[model samples]
Target: KPMTNYQIPQNTLLKFRIFNEFLMANERHVAKEVRDEYVDTMSKIYYSYFKGYSSRLTKLQYEEAAARDDLMGVEDTAKKGFFSSKPHMKNRSTVFTLGNRGEVLTTELEAPVIVPHAAAKNETRYSFECIFRSLHFALMDNCCREFLFISDFFMVSGAGSQNLFEAIMGKTLTLFLKLMEDSVQDCYDSIGIFLSAHIVYRYQSIMTKRNIPALDRYWDTILNHLWPRFEYIVTMNIQSVRECEPNKLGHIDNRPHYITRRFAEFSAAIVGISTTYPNDRVNRVLGQLQAEVENFILKMAAEFPHRKEQLIFLINNYDMMLSVLVERTTDDSKESEMYR
Candidate 1:
């Protein structure tokens, strides 16, 4: 039977509960292949929605132009008035206008002295919002059901504990429900895809850097210590989230976890640290981390013995995931080929 609107909440709630349990209880151990599958699925969804949105926004600009023209007549009223003014009016206007002009004027000036400063600021803040709304609607129409599939999968995979679960689920569901109602699933989907890909890419980068002693030391000291606390201070100032809430959501949350804050700080610190590190020190750290990551991969392969092929696949194709993430985050209009 086709699902009704009323069924959505119930389905989402059930899925959330089920997914949370799976994450918490599943000891089956996911293969690298499985993780890669999620990465690929997420990338595909993100790129599709992103490209579709760019196209829709382009069309929307044209449509908005047409709508504005339809509403505000295009004839240059100011020009018409200036041209139609009587000689006296022109002389008076000229005196005020020609004050800045050369004292000994030729028969004609190449351009208008003041150019009337068109001042046609067609402030379309509301229209832009509507265009965003339209893009969302288009996405939801096509991909909402599929999005629920991924959301459900993540929810059950023990991404957070019950309290954290409720918070994340509540927020995610609220956004989903709003998108469903407003028919803006496309925007939501695009964001979700981008976010998912971003998370994966970050995780991969962190994993890659695990072996580097200096890098790890830098991250541990800067990110794990100073950064998270700094973020906590900012959050306290904003008074955004309850002090008691878990900070797992990072920047997405008003009050993120200390760990989440640490991660952000650490990541931020790396950018600064990279510049300070001597070339030899940087190379040494990178070499160490690469060896460690390779060792870790080998250990994972051994433990999952049967999944060697999948691990190889992931190692070989990881760049694709990063590429998708970069494409999603970049401005689409620059070099249309970036979309591919």
Candidate 2:
């Protein structure tokens, strides 16, 4: 089934219905007396369900799901195994033993370790060549065909190395960092020219649920896809032009000094930082915040004192208001109580 077409299970639907009753009772559209009556009825329902039968029902449901193979995967891997487990001990160690007649014996000796310097050099050369080819494709081939179709708002021009330079200097710094993160001394950088498309695909899937406007979605596509491609092109061009040059006076001056070389240096900056201080947590939080920010702000504005003066009032009277609200809801002296 399409993800959007998937139906919620009947039992889960009932649970949601019960949860929504509490929400409906507190709904602002309803009259205070009627809402108060609902609050009283909900007090009974809440006590009967949550304080009484909910735990038993939950237990039964879990057992049922487990038996029917409907439970979420329960392998230790799913819970805390990876995070909690200690480092694995090395299973094998080199050992020598005396064989019959004092002859030396070994148990499955490991192969000799050797560094293939020439092969490593050749691999590095090949990888650099690939980076150059990728840059060429981005600047010359792809842009030649697509430039007219792509909006000029990205300020992208199909002419000159200045376009390449601007792309690196302007908006591609992040992509350059990412590519540098993937690059290795004697290995090919993973071709991530198409990665932005996948990112946009995932972004669209998320935004569709929030009913994001068409214009915002369009801009999202441009930001995620168009910008990344240009960045890749610029970074690769930097590597191709500056790093490929022969050193002068037999002394190595491999440090990037030119404009493109500076961008290359920027790429190099990501080398150790990305591994030592990975941005996975920050990136995850960013993705979540971007998706939920609108709804979160809307909820806060609707439910709480959000204006400057209102917030000042809340800060000044925080204790008194809290006490009053708590008493109003929980105190039993009133003829009607919000909840029991």
Candidate 3:
């Protein structure tokens, strides 16, 4: 008395096969009116089968895996539903009166589940901490909180926070303005971070498809956008440090100025560390780094002609300052070697 896999009702199977044959043959040659009617009829049949299968599988969620075999029965119906009516999915909401006097009411509401802030905040904090620790171990280890603050600023700005636009000067400015209104710390929601990774992946995929040059081509766009902010920080920190300690005497006097002084100090520290054991390798690396920075500026100027002169001015000032530091370092090294 057991049913066979292929033992569908004979009459129903026959009718379905006939309809299928008609569809395959008439799809291209059928009169418009007949095609429309056939499509409408088939659609209704498809949805009915779809709903029936969905209801049954939902019930089976609590059932044993042995019952999973039944899912195959409606797989075609489900596929039809997905392709045919995906755009028409609607939210369902209802209210019911419970009491005799209608004083008590019950409501049902549905929405896409979103990650809660408490969970999101924890995830953001964890990601920031992990990245911070990694950078610390990588010899770029100074200014823990300062780097965090910059990351936070970028996050809050949101405009250029995504990898694709982060290098753009205009987007960076837009993000800066936006950051003024919100805390960047709060912007690192887990979902936002996850989506950001996906966005970056998609951008890379498109760029690869287009056969674009990766580093050199995009360098200028990023530098032009990032350098103004860098310059702003330098200018701001110089003023702040000077204001904090009018006389730059000792570590004690500088302690109060550390907040703003950290920026310049960090830059100098990196340069010093890179040259501690000087060799051709060190010089070559430094040259490459400087060239990259210059390329970034050139790219920015090329992309934004209106601001080309202004950026060139900033680049010149930056180069001059860096050159002075190198000269001083060379002098001190020679003097120390002579004494030794």
TM-score of each: 0.23, 0.19, 0.22
List residue ranges in candidate 1 displaced over 4 A.
Answer: 1-32, 63-76, 79-129, 138-148, 154-340
Residue-pair clashes per candidate? 14, 0, 4
Q: List the candidates ranked by TM-score, beginning with the highest.
A: 1, 3, 2
For model 3, residues 1-340, the per-residue Cα lDDT tens digits are 1112212432344445555456546674443444345335533443343334323322321111111111111122332334575322111100000112110111101111112243345532222112212211111111122122223322323322233222322232333233322321332122222222222233334445543322222333332433333233333323333333222322221111222122223333324433422334334433443343344334333443356564664455455444444543454543223223
Better lDDT candidate (1, 3): 1
Q: How many clashing residue pairs are found in candidate 1?
A: 14
Segments in model 3 whose C-alpha atoms lie over 4 Å from true places: 1-122, 126-211, 214-219, 245-265, 268-340
Alpha-carbon error at 162 in model 1, in Å? Answer: 14
Q: Rate the local accuracy (lDDT) of all candidates.
A: 0.31, 0.28, 0.29
**Model 1 reaches what TM-score against the true structure?**
0.23
lDDT for position 136 in model 3: 17
For model 1, the local distance difference test gives 0.31
Looking at candidate 1, what is the lDDT of residue 140?
Answer: 30
lDDT of each residue in 1-340, candidate 1, tens digit only = 1113434654665555655455546733553345345446544544554454444343432121211111101122322335565231121111111122121112211122111112114322212223333333333322334334434555532233223233322333334334333332222121112222222233234334532111222223222322233233222322322221222222221122222222222222222223322234333433343333333334333433356554563444233423432433333322113224
Q: Ten residues in a row with the worst lDDT in model 2?
A: 94-103
- Residue pairs of candidate 3 with colliding backbone atoms: 167-222, 169-225, 220-299, 220-300
Please tell me which predicted candidate would have the highest lDDT against the true structure.
Answer: 1
